[model samples]
Target: MTRLFNDPTAFADELIDGFVAAHPGHVRPVRGGVVRATRCTSDTVALVIGGGSGHYPAFGGLVGPGIAHGAAMGNLFASPSTQQIVSVARAASNGGGILLSYGNYAGDVLNFDAAEAQLNAEGIPTRTVRVTDDIASAPASEKHRRRGIAGDLTVFKVAGAAAEAGYVLDEVVRVAELANERTRSFGVAFTGCTLPGASEPLFTVPEGRMALGLGIHGEPGIGETDIPSADGLAQLFVEELLAELPEGVASPKGRRVALVLNGLGSVKYEELYVVYGCIARRLQEAGVTIVEPEVGEFCTSFDMAGVSLTLFWLDTELELFWRAGADTPGFRKGLVSPRPRVSAESGVQKKPSSEAVMVPASEESRAAAPRIVAAVDAIAAVIDAHVEELGRIDAVAGDGDHGIGMQRGATAARAAAHAAVEAGAGAGSVLLRAADAWSDRAGGTSGALWGVMLRALGTRIGDEDAPDAHAIAEGAADALAGIRSYGKAEVGDKTMVDAIVPFVETLVARVIDGEQLGDAWDAAAAAATAAAAATADLLPRVGRARPHAEKSLGTPDAGAHSFGLIATAVAATLTRKDFAR
Candidate 1:
């Protein structure tokens, strides 16, 4: 449990501030995250790695020479916004291209890929190599679908080393991909981790039992078993990994591998050593040759009592990179030469935000701004009332941050909408402000999707004219299209798309049939509600929940459920006489 904190909402930001203050020599704070303080060559490829903020050494600590050049940190258990990634990449780039890497989670992939595309458009070459190394997350036949765990280190290390070796951008990306393919990890937890201000752990293991295949984000394990001895656990890890060696590797006998016995937060150094001692003996007995075996916290959950084993099978080239020296805030290897330190320029200028465009509007549309503000407030209130229940549902198969993320996004959007209305903004302008606020504060898949929806809807509702029933329907259509374009989730993927698609289709049909705005919205809300409930029968095929698809059965997706709830609540608000005015 997390005991020390100011406001829970400000934890991540404050932690970053203090971390940078404490380690100025190793890291310097940038707009998005921390970057290496040590200067790099003018034409060296920058390795920018990241995910959520809870994973400490994994991201920020790994920023230095021979490691990640920068890390785009997000809120706890959430992927960084595309803007954040872009900011970090811009801060780290030095003429050479940028190579982005992270665990292969849906949010990470979507955000990073968007950032990569944006950088390329800006004439800065960029590439991405997602790490999918958790053997327990997917079968050998579908290894590409696996979620990365502790093995994130293997890919990050190899990629950074390749970049340090002055390999071109393409070769650096190739080495990172190869490292990802060779690495495999499995994790187990004796206890669950609790986020700040949360009353309970996201999930728990029963007394005398252990959870298997647990995620680093407080997500519950896929299976449970009786607790095993240190030696038993080590043997289990070795056997499980060796059972499915990478293609062309018949056996581990005489093959050199880099081994990482990582402690997932609460587990102490002594415990890791105990486990690693057994692991070492077992590997030697199995005819496996281990090189550069590391035992400590390389990645972590906030305070999970767990451990993970990563096997990075090494070829000759990989072996040389694996043995290379690294100097970083969290990790140090071999001898490193002292280098001159640097920092982000204090006078650096920021670019205009996407919403900086000045939109023209009519008095009629401007008059409708108050209604949009009211709708935003209504949505936020409903989300506030259901935060806990939504979190509970999400915990079944995903990191249980959906509720908090929504709450933060809704709060931010409400504030932004109110400010826009007070400033005499039109409906479209209010919606656009709210959209940016939601995405910026929320920082997750939900945040990103909600932002896209709001922005698309705002664009269609153009400030120049009052939005009629047809205009509203078109806005909904645009929102749905934006979601599909970025999220890539179809109707049956068990995401908010399931509810939103039906809502848009139904509303569009009703409006075309001559129904009024309020009536059409009520009908659409009902359709969304029904579709959301139907998600209980679906198995997730995307996002963080996909790996635990079976566990999500019989429960509606939290995002879909929330969409239905918000749509219904907004319908009631829209039916008010004040809104009709």
Candidate 2:
């Protein structure tokens, strides 16, 4: 992996030099790799933010009129030395003392503190504000000691706004402290992030598993678990934050939340927003009103595949500064909020209620209740039986969550079946029931994909006749087509398609070959078994597990494994009578 750099050692310095060259009126580079952005005056208190590099628009790009006065930029993922922080402190501070801010990291505290004392000796009163918003880092006993994740932007913005509004150094630091106190963040990593010029990642996150509570530096999060959808993951993250919310943040007045959807490194803002939509819905359900939301890559790691959500409890005054107009290169003034602008608008605005959307299940779904229930029960049993086997394979190539995912899906499917049966619903209705239940229980693409397949199959079953080669083959074809339509994956993607494609194809071929339904199913099962084996030679073509393509070269996909298990269950449905003389 090539990087955009002249050299790793002087990457920060060279970038700062070029930046000053490009914007001479805006900034000037100093010793120890600090960039003092212009407007260095003796009248106003200065804002100094610093940290390791790679998280751009931070500690550097954020330097401007309403942002930081100057930034003590560090090397890539490396905190600046004490001397560097001290030098930037002096350069940025004119007559007014400085308020220093950085993420919650040991090296940053040490270096910045040393700089603070040094500036104090020079008659420049200095204060340090540490951003510690990651709620996943510690419990209440250690909340003050948790690592800062993405909420640093809110801290920077609040602190900078205070300073720009002519607040004294002490007041500016107070704002920073308040921002940190109000904020909480948590995240899960899909994969570890690799640093610039490094061949390997800073850490390894097992495939198909999300490391909940993962730190910015690729640290272990809550023990690895099955990767859920963007919606489910957001729910988990928000619930964790809600569980750990500090006392004294009430609603409608003193209770306002400032949300920050921060990209850890490589995850895009669009994906982050999909997760944010989940969180927003849940928070509203909980009666926590959003004061303001800043959604974008405010703070980031180095191409780490993860996202962090930060919620800051706000007071009336703090909320004002948060909404205050400011223009930084990356963070600009936000849109006019729907709330009363307090700037004296003419008329009271009417808020529109949402229109309800309704979709009814297909009639086919209403007719196939018994078959759907039986299928779900048998499939659940298969998962229960092969749990250890699936885990063993996953342990070799992933974080070992495949068994958990499958079992969870089966459990959900069974629950949906039971509910449908109790309600006297048909198969199609039961499948529609399974869709939401399965998504709630299972976490990844396969989980939703399979649930959709079941739902679609249920709808088709209304037209399905009693077991016969032609009817069975057609129904099987419908199920497979529905799966393909929902998942949008081609055959040979090394997914469940390995078993699914051949299983359906073989059944169709057998029916055309004049076989009975039982004989066709047998043939289909055998073909699926072959496809599962053939998966050993295929490459991954989709999902989070795709990157590790070559790694599972000789292993059967868990999807294929799950399909084979289902086929076995279907085959077992056939029985032989006690043989007589």
Candidate 3:
């Protein structure tokens, strides 16, 4: 449980500020995250690594010489926004191409892939290699879908070292992919972690029991069993990893592997050492040679009492890179030669201005702008009221941050809409600005999808005139199209798409039948509400919940629930005197 915090929402930002102040020699603050304080050769590829903020040392702390050159840190348990990733990558780039790597969670994949595409379009070459090392998350045939865990270090280290050694971006990507292919991890938790300001843990194991196949994002484990002895746990880890060797490894015997016995927060280092002792003996007896075994917290949940074991089967090239020197805030190996500090004027780049050139609006459109602002405000209010419940629902099978993420996005959207309205922007412009702010501030799968939805609708409802029922319905249809295209989730996938699809279809049908805007919206909102409730009977087929699909059987997806709530609130806003047809 995180006890000390002024505001839970501000924890990630405050910690980054303090972290930069404490490690000035290792890292410098940038707009989205941190970059190495030291200078690098112009030809050296920049390795940009990151994910959510809770995993200390994983992201920001690894920004230095032979680790990540920069880290695009995001909000607690949320992926960094695409804008943040680009900002950090630009700051870290030194003429050489950039390599982006991170855990293979859904949010991280979406944002990082977007950033990679954006950077390439901007003429800054960039590529990505998602780390998929948690064997428990997926079957061997579907290894590409596995979640990254402690094995993130092995991939990051190899890629960072390759970049530091002046490998080209393509070469860096190759070795990183190889490292990811060879790595495997498994974990178990005695208890779940509680996020800041939360009264209870996200998920809990019964007394005298432990959860198996735990995720680092406070997601509940896949299964539960009686707590095992230290030696018993060690044997369990070794056997699980040994059962499925990487391709080309005929057997575990005679293999030289880099082992990481990672403590997931509240688990003590001494406890890890106790387990590692037995693990080491077991491996030695099996004729396996362990190299550079690390025993401590690498990636962690906030305060989860758990441990994970990672086996990085090292080929000769990987072994050399694995032993390479690194000088980062959280990790160091051998000795790195001193490098000059980056010039004060260099590194961090100015953020692009959010203000767009305002197109003149008709009197009717200007008059309708206030209603749009009100709708955004209503969204914020609804999310704020239901945040706790949303988090609880999400904790059933996913990280319990959906509520916080939606609150951040809606609050930011509300503020941005107000600012746009004050600047004399019309309805479309206000929504466009709000869309950008929501995505930039929220920084996750939900955030990205919301941005897509809002932008699509805003574009369709141009500033030339006040939108009628037909136009609003068309815009909503466009939003639905954009969301489906961007998120790649369908109606039966148990995502927000389930609710969104029905809402858009109903709204379009009602408007086509000549219903007024308010009446049509009310009907659509009701459809969405029913669809959201119906999601409880359907298992999640995508995103973080897929690994623990059974646990989510009785709980509706938080995204779908929140979307339903927002649609209902927006219907109320449309029925107000200012927005009435």
| 2 or 3, greater by lDDT | 3
Task: Show where candidate 1 strays beyond 4 Å.
Answer: 343-357, 576-581
Error of 3 at 195 (Å): 0.6
Q: How would you encode candidate 2's per-residue C-alpha lDDT over 235-345 as one tens digit per residue? A: 887778787766676442335788988887778878978888888888888878886787778776667788888888888878888888665455667542221111213
Q: Model 3, 1-581: lDDT tens per residue?
A: 88988888788889999999999999998888999999999978999999999999888988998989999999989999998999999999988899999999999988999999999999999999999999999999999899999999999999999998889999999999999999999999999999898999999999999999999999888888899999999999999999999998999889999999999899998888999999999999888999998899889888999999999999999999999999999998988999999888875753564567777887888888998999999999999999899999999999999989998899999999999888888888888999999998899899999998898888888798887777788999999999888888998999999999999999999878878889889999999999999999999999999999999998898899999999999998886233333
Task: Give per-residue CA lDDT, model 1, range 64-174, as digits (tens).
Answer: 888899998888888888878898899889778999999988888888988999999999999999999998888889888888888999899989988999999999999
Q: TM-score for every candidate vs. truth?
A: 0.96, 0.56, 0.98
Global fold similarity of model 2 (TM-score) = 0.56
Clash pairs of candidate 2? 228-443, 264-301, 365-428, 365-429, 368-427, 369-427
lDDT-sorted candidate list, best first: 3, 1, 2
Local distance difference test, per candidate?
A: 0.88, 0.68, 0.91
Name the best candidate (by lDDT): 3
